[model samples]
Target: MSEQPVVPDVAAPAGRGPLLEVVGLAAYVRLGLFGIIGQHTWDAPDLASSQRMLAIGLRVGEQQGRLLAIGASHGVEPVELMRPFAGVLDSFEARTPESSWWEGLLKGVVGHGVASDLCRLLARGLPGDLAAQVVGAMEYTDDDERATSIVRAGVEADGRLGSRLALWGRRVVGESLSLSQALLTTRPSFGELARAAMPATVAPEGPSADVVAWVLGELTAEHTRRMDRMGLAA
Candidate 1:
């Protein structure tokens, strides 16, 4: 991000494989995330908590629609594009399932934040206007604060719970990043996609291989900032 954005050749931009994959990944991660909102509401501790969780679920629903539109704009249906990785969420949860309802809340925040952060990182390589669309589509809502407040309050009430959640957050960050890295490396076209999306004006950031490294670093830094903001350790 230190260097200014580089816009690539718009010649074949219409159907490049990379942006589609990135968009698909964004949509895929988001698709997997939708179910957790329901989990949040269903397992919410009380009426007020359930109501708040439901509100958050509604906001997530809006983002899901936006992602659909983004995919449509790209002339690719994300649902079909993501079919190859259909079990991604199942694998993610299997590796980092929440032990309790409260832990699920924490995972929702940390996990989605990490996923979106990666998509936002890759989206930077898209052309100016398109990049803005992808970035804006991922923007946070007040519901984020509503959810985090619940987790923070719970932590304040119980120091032991806070300690366990901190560990959980650390575990989730690793898994989420691992998933992102896997996506970036899964196809060679991804590097081409990123390079294709990048503005041509900026010189190569480094080797194409460095792109994944750079993106992961950015993701981790952003995730840590989020952890700090939420007053959670680990």
Candidate 2:
């Protein structure tokens, strides 16, 4: 029989148990994305596409439920956790408004992808059970592919649309990175957790010492891959 590969001891590296605030933050992100996607579904260019996006929104709703469940151990309800950051995501969307159907679709793809990545990476310092759950809650490969398909097909149809979306993709990446950094920096209890999530090569200094830059680099690299998969420029 083949031997199983060893899983590293994430407990020590995780530093401490799950930060309840981080769990709330993750729930708020998905909850907000679900609401925004529902609106986007209604505003889709056609009924057929709207129906498809609505289905995707349903899946996002389910993921939001999972994220909330992760907070169950803390005895916090979904709303309680999400209430603190009431207008956070709305602000993000406002900063990068969509001017067209394709832009709107890319908003869902780029925004949700980057935000979820940030949440999962930051949640890595949590305990084994909660950390695993947080990681699972953020896993949305199928949803990304489905949403990316919508944008990918549209961009493939119009070369000009591809050009426009490529620009939009870059804009969203920058805005998304800025928001993520702001969230980690401004949130009262997240400093240690963010430090724990840093790359192993970097020493655990304060938030200023190469932390934000490394995270931005990691997220930007992932965003570039997603854009490449859709045949769009990063």
Candidate 3:
């Protein structure tokens, strides 16, 4: 058998920020989840896939809480930060079949477990003044409803607005990219994975209009297919 190719290390520059560190942590968590879920399905419990699925749910909850807390701390509304991604959420929702077994599983894993955990974590992470507010926003127990509302609000508001929202979206993307870069720099294995997943010319900077267009195109294609499947559109 041919040996798996080795991944190269990418060193982090001095004076990296907290956001980048957070990104690295998230990447490690995701990689761990992917490894277990992708490779060891047969070994996993048929009832719940793998231990990694549980871990992912827990971690997602924790991360979501952190994100909400951070937004509260900065006096930025969580909904506002999420607004730009509303279109993406709509695409996912519209594409997903509500009655499918996969849908039920996702609701349990992502909506209830992950979303609930995230809200709890966010409340725990917040300071005295902001904690209540953060917790309240996450209080809606229905994961699907909460997710849909947040994403939809973000998309609708962002679309209605002009350059300001675009700028904010750019900042969010920049911060996320910084976080991904930090992960790549710290973990050679993760760096290799990212390189494999992403294109060579991709940079640790804001996404361009072309990137957004490509994303929209993919989402549109999926949406069209989903609509056709449901006999809602051609």
> In TM-score terms, which candidate is top?
2
Output candidate 3 Cα RMSD. 20.1
Q: What is the per-residue lDDT of model 1 for residues 129-199, given as tens digits with 9 covering 90 to 100?
A: 77788788877657777778888888888989889989999999899888877767765655655555554
Q: What is model 1's C-alpha RMSD?
A: 8.5
lDDT of 3 by residue, 76-104 (tens): 45544343222222222333323422223
Worst 10 residues of 1 by lDDT: 4-13
lDDT-better candidate, 1 vs 2? 2
TM-scores for the candidates:
0.83, 0.86, 0.27
Candidate 2 residue-wise lDDT, 14-85, digit = tens: 322336667666787777677767878877878988998888888888888887886676677776566566
Show where candidate 3 strays beyond 4 Å: 1-55, 83-88, 102-234
Give the C-alpha miss distance for residue 166 in model 3, angstroms: 35
For candidate 3, the per-residue lDDT at 88 reads 23
Q: List candidate 1 segments past 4 Å from native.
A: 1-16, 192-205
Model 3: lDDT of residue 234: 16
Candidate 3: C-alpha lDDT:
0.36
lDDT of each: 0.74, 0.76, 0.36
Give the candidate order by descending TM-score: 2, 1, 3
